[model samples]
Target: MSPVVIPARIKKILIIKPSAFGDIIHSLPFLNAVKSTFPNARIDWVVAHGLHTFLEGHPMIDKLWVIKKDQWKKIGYLKSTLNEIFGLVKGLGKEKYDIAFDLSGILRSGLITLASKAYMKIGFEESDEGSPFFYTHKIKGGMDNHAIDRYLKLAGFIGCDTSSVNYPFAPFDNHSDICNILPPNYVVISPSAGKPANQWPAEKYGELASMLPLPSVVISSGADAAIAERVVKFSQGKALSIAGKTTLKGLMPIIKGARFFITNDTGPMHLAAALEVPVVAVFGPANPVRTGPYGSIHRVIQKKLPCSPCYAWQPCSHWRCMNELTVREVFDVVKEMTET
Candidate 1:
C-alpha cells in the first residue's frame, strides 16, 4: 500500500508499543531516529503500567499514556479495565495527533491507533489480528529481520533518518543501592525466561556459574524467585541471589557494571546487549536470528536440532533443544568470551 503524506509540520505524535522488556529495547533506536527527525514536535507514548517505569523520565518523550493492561486480564477487574480503556480512548482523541505509529501491531495496539484518530495512522501490513486494516498507511515489516531493523524500517518510512542505530536510554546513575550487597566483581546470570520453553535448566546455570572466574549474581522478578534461588542453591557458594531486590531502573547499573552477562533469551539479556555488556545468551525454542542479542559482542548457544526455534512457549514432554544443551557446552563459549 502507498504511504500517506505526512503533514509539513507535525505538532504532536503518538507511538504505540507497550509491555515486555526485550521488545521495548528493540524500539529505542526508532525512538531516537524519530526524536532527531521531529525535534520540535511533542511525542507521547502509550506504555503499559510496569514497563512504563523503564521509559519513565525518558528525555525524548513528552507524555506517557500509562495503561492498566496487565490488570485487564483479571476477570474481577473487568469493570475498572473498561473504565480505564474509555479514559485512554477519550484522552488520546483529545491529543489531536498528526501522526500515530502502531509499532506493536496487535489487536490492542490497533485499537490504540484508532483511538488516537491521528491524521496518518501507520503500522506494518504483517501486523497480527487484522491490525493492518486499522492503519491508513502500512509498511512491509519483514518477519525475518531483526526487531531493531524492523522498527527502524518504520522510522525510514516516516521520513526519519535511520543512518545511526543507537539505544538512547533515559539518564541513569552508575551506582545502585543493591550493589552494596553484590560481590565486588561478578558475572550476572539471568537464569529465568519469560517462557518455560526458552529457559535452559536453572541448575545448569548454577553449574556454569561455578566454573566462571568470578562469583555470579542472579536477577529476576519476585515471580521467578524460585528459579533464581535454585540457581543460587546449586552454585556451591559461587553465586548469590538478588531476585526481587531491585526495580527496573535499578537493573541498569547492575547490568552495566557486571563483568559479563549470562542469560536465557529474556529481557535483561537484551538490556545487557544494549549496554555493550558481553552476553552469552542460551536459546531454546525461540529464533535467535530475529530476537537474539543485537550486537556483534554476543554469543548465542543453542543445540542444533531441526525442531529448534519452534517458539513453543509451553514446553513439550522432552524439549531437547534446551534439555540436550549441557553446562559444559555453554561454558566453552563463556570461557572463550572471558579469555578474549
Candidate 2:
C-alpha cells in the first residue's frame, strides 16, 4: 500500500538515526531539508550520547534525546531501561508531534518511531516489512541512489525543498583561537576506517605521507594507538600521529584548519568533505557512490575487482583492491587535485 501523506499543518517532527558515525553525519542534510520546509516546526532528533556532541545546539533541531543502548541492553537494568524509554516516550508524546521520521530505517529506528507514537510516521519503503508497519509513509531508498539524495527525497515528499545538502557543523566554529598553532599549509591524513579491509596499508600511508608537499599529521582512533604507531614508524619522521591524544570533539578544529585531507573512506573523510576541504579518499570494498566523501575537491580510488565493493565488515585475508594501490598513485591524485 502507498504511504498516506499528512497535512502541511504538521508542525512537530521526531527524527531517529542511532549509529554508525558516517551514516549519522550523512543524515544531517535530510534534517536540514525538513527544517527548510518547516522553519517554525520544532524538530527533535533521537541519537546516542556521544553523537549528540556533533549535533549540539543545531539550529534545525530544537532538542536532542540521547539514547543509551548499552544501558538498555544490560541484563539487570531492564527495569531502568524501561523507565528511561517511558520517559522518552512521554516527552515525545508531550510534544504532540504530527510527523515522525525513521531516517535510520533500521530495526532500532523502527522501535524509536513506535515509541514516539506520532500520528504520521515516515521511513524508507525498502526497510524491513515489520519496520515499515509502524510508519504511515515510506520513501524509496537503496544502493542505486546516493544516500543523501535518498533521505532528501523523503523530506521532498513532505513538501521540503531540501534541494541542497547542508552541513550544520561546517559554519559553526566551536574551536579555540589557537588556530595559529597549526602549520600554515598542512595535510590531514586519517589512516583509519571502521574495517581493516577498507583501510590502506599503514606503510603505504607512511610512504604517501613522505611524498605529500606539506607537513602531515596522522589521525587514528584513540583506542587503537598501534595503527598510528605503525604509520609513524613507516613515515620515518615525516608524520606525527595524534592517536589517543584528541577527543572526537577536539579533532574537528584540526580537521577544519587543514589545507587538504587524505584518508580511507571513514567518518572524518566525510567530515572533511563537509567542511569543504579537498580530500583524496581511498576506497576498496565499499561503494564510494553510496558513502564516499561528497564534495567537488575529492578523488575516490577503487580498483573494481570482480568482487569489488563487497562491503565486508570483517577483515579480508586477501584485500586485492587495496593491496594493488601504490602510495604514488594516491600522492599523484592529491597533487593533481591540489595543483589544479
Candidate 3:
C-alpha cells in the first residue's frame, strides 16, 4: 500500500480506539508518534465511557469523545442506543476532521471512522469485521507482532517516527488516599483477567502472595472483587485486599510506586508495564509474545504445553496450561525479580 501523505493543511485528526484498558495503553505510543509528527494538529480520541477517565486530561489529545458502549449494548436501551448512535455520527460529521484513524478495527469503530467524514481515513488491512472497507488507506498490521508494535505500524504509515516507542501520558497527581492505605514498598497483585480461561486460580495467587518477601496489595475493580477476596482469604492474611477502591487514574501511582507487580493476563498487567514497573505475569490460553507485559525487566511465567498459546476465548475441557503452573514456580520468579 502507498504511504499516506499528510497535506500541509492537515490540522484536526481523530483517532478511534474505544474500549479495553490494555488496548488503550497499547495505542498510547501511536498517539505519541502522531503528536510528535504533527505537533500543531488537534488530536481527538473516541474512547469508551468508563475508560475515558484515563484520557480525560491527556496532554496530547484535544478532545475525548466518550461513547457509552456498554450501556448501548443492553437490550432494554434500544431507543437510547439509536439516538446516541445518530447523535455521535452527527456530532463527528461536524468536526470536519482532516484525518481519521480507526485503530480499534471493529465494526463499531469502522462506522465511527466513516461517520467522521474526514478527508483521509486510515486503518489496518487485516482489521476484523470488514472494517478495512471503511479506510481510504490501509496499512499491514501483523497479527503476530506485539499490539504496541502493530499500532506503531499505523503511525509509520502516516510518516510519523515509530523508531522510539514512547507513552506521552499527561502527568497525574498521585492519589494520596491510595498511597496512605498502601504499605511502604509493597508488591501489587492483579489476579483477575477478563476471560476466566486466562486467569490463574485465585487460591494460587494467594499462595504466591503468602510466600513473597514484601507485603502484597491485591487490587481489583468492582467486578473482580470476589476474585481479590478469594486471593486475600487464601493468603491467610498475608495479602491485603484493596478491591473496588481505586479509579484507573488512581491506579497509576499505586503501580508506579510498586516494588514489583504480579498478575494474570489482564488490563492492570499492561498498566504496570506502561508505568515501567517490573512485572511477573502468568500466562495461560493467551499468547504472551503478542500481549504479555512489554519491556526487558518484566518476566512471563507460562507452561509450554503442546497446545499452549491456544488463544481460546472459551475454557478448554482440561485447561492444562494454567492448571499445570504451580505457585512455587511463580514465587521463584518473584524472588529472582526482587533480588535484583
What C-alpha lDDT values do all the predictions have?
0.90, 0.80, 0.90
How would you encode candidate 2's per-residue C-alpha lDDT over 1-340 as one tens digit per residue? 3324546567889888876677777888888877766778888889887777777767688888998876887979899889888898788777777889887776767877987878888888888647887787777876577778778778787777765789665235567444455567788889878887788888898888878778787887787678877888888677787786765667778888898888998888888887788888899998988888886678898887999889988657888889898888888888888779
The root-mean-square deviation over C-alpha atoms between each candidate and the true structure, in angstroms, is 1.3, 2.5, 1.2
**Stretches of model 1 off by over 4 angstroms after superposition:** 1-8
Write down the TM-score for model 3: 0.97
Q: How many clashing pairs in candidate 1?
A: 0
lDDT of 1 by residue, 35-61 (tens): 898888999999988999999889999
lDDT of 2: 0.80
TM-scores for all candidates? Answer: 0.97, 0.91, 0.97
Off-target runs (Cα >4 Å) in candidate 3 are none
Badly placed stretches (over 4 Å) of model 2 are 1-8, 74-80, 170-181
lDDT value for candidate 1? 0.90
How much does candidate 2 score in TM-score?
0.91
* Candidate with best lDDT: 1
